[model samples]
Target: MAIESVVVRQRVEDLDAAVPFYERLTGSTASRFAFAGVTLASVGPFLLFSGPDEAVRRVAGVAATLAVGDLDAAVEDAVAGGAEVVAPSAPTPNGHRAVLRHPHGGVYEYVGP
Candidate 1:
């Protein structure tokens, strides 16, 4: 079966602080979505957050993982966007992956096939 899409949700303490960094990493501006006092940023295949909610915080960890067409480019872009590489890009048990930390303590994983 074909996987249509994937989305990972993260809870944030402040939405505004998270947007620009994500926008830079994804190389696309976030499409904002709000409901029930929750704000979300749709960055390509992942959905990220910024707003207060205890339950969301408890459930959120390693917020999203992006499957990219080019690992090298993604890594370079992430670095240029001010993301700190938590894990350098390398082949994993599953595939190639690299971890990056956003300015606001959110984590993202970039994987390539």
Candidate 2:
């Protein structure tokens, strides 16, 4: 597997407000998606969030995103390793991705380019 390392992710309290700020910062529009009552914005490989306090508390920071060539395979591996598919694989405005919660509570996004 070619693990290209973590790309980008940011934890925020309000996704509604955060997206606009990030859009301006990146000088690009956000590709938005809803997961776990939180909104996610993708600007290139950066996965930024604005959502529930609980979700933010759990992640507590920028959750690492692994850029995998095949998102399905990475998700399968995560599941086999006792990770739960917090967000199933799907096509977003940015690309394709799936969110997993590791057995130890760390959240990760396996993303495809």
Candidate 3:
């Protein structure tokens, strides 16, 4: 599958307070959305997330959201490449997503249309 954008994830205590910095840094206004219980904002390729500690902790320090052409195919590729699936693929505001932990222990959220 062809990889699209890689979105960096940032977990913050307050979405409102955290957005301005990203906006300034990327020189782009953030587009807002809510997924599950978390509030999200996209500024350039950065995805800022804020929500309850329990939910945030699940994705804390996640390297990046890999955008792909097909979610199922990406999940299959990840498993074949020795990545452990943390969460099965599911629908998201943008499209679909799944979480995986690489063999080296790097966790990432993969998103696809």
Candidate 4:
């Protein structure tokens, strides 16, 4: 599958406080959404998420979100490449997402339309 875009996710303690900074940094207003308990905003290629410690912790320090052409194929390819599945493919506001630990031990989320 071809990678479409790379989204940088930043886990923050306060969505209100974080949005302005990213908006200025990206020079664009953010599109907001809520998933599970997390408040998310998309500004340019950045995705800012804020929520409870537990929910945010799960994605903290993740390398990046790899937007791809095929979510299923990407997951399969990741597994075949010695990556470990952290979260199976599931629906999200944008599309679908699956977390994986690359063979070299980097954690990332794969997203697709």
Best candidate, TM-score: 4
lDDT of 3 by residue, 64-95 (tens): 98888888998898899899999899887788
Clashing pairs in 2: 15-50
Off by over 4 Å in 4: none
Query: Which runs in model 2 stand beyond 4 Å of their true positions?
Result: 11-62
lDDT of 1 by residue, 4-102 (tens): 244676566777887787788778888886533556777765577665665355335556777777777877877787889988898754468777897
Error of 2 at 78 (Å): 1.4
| Model 1 ranges with Cα > 4 A deviation | 1-60
For each of the candidates, the C-alpha root-mean-square deviation to the true structure, in angstroms, is: 11.4, 4.3, 1.7, 1.5
The better candidate by TM-score, 2 or 3, is: 3
Cα lDDT of model 1 overall? 0.69
Runs in model 3 lying further than 4 Å from the true structure: none
Scanning candidate 3 in windows of ten residues, the lowest lDDT window is 53-62
TM-score of each model, in listed order: 0.47, 0.56, 0.85, 0.88
Per TM-score, what order, best first? 4, 3, 2, 1
C-alpha displacement of 59 in model 1, angstroms?
Answer: 12
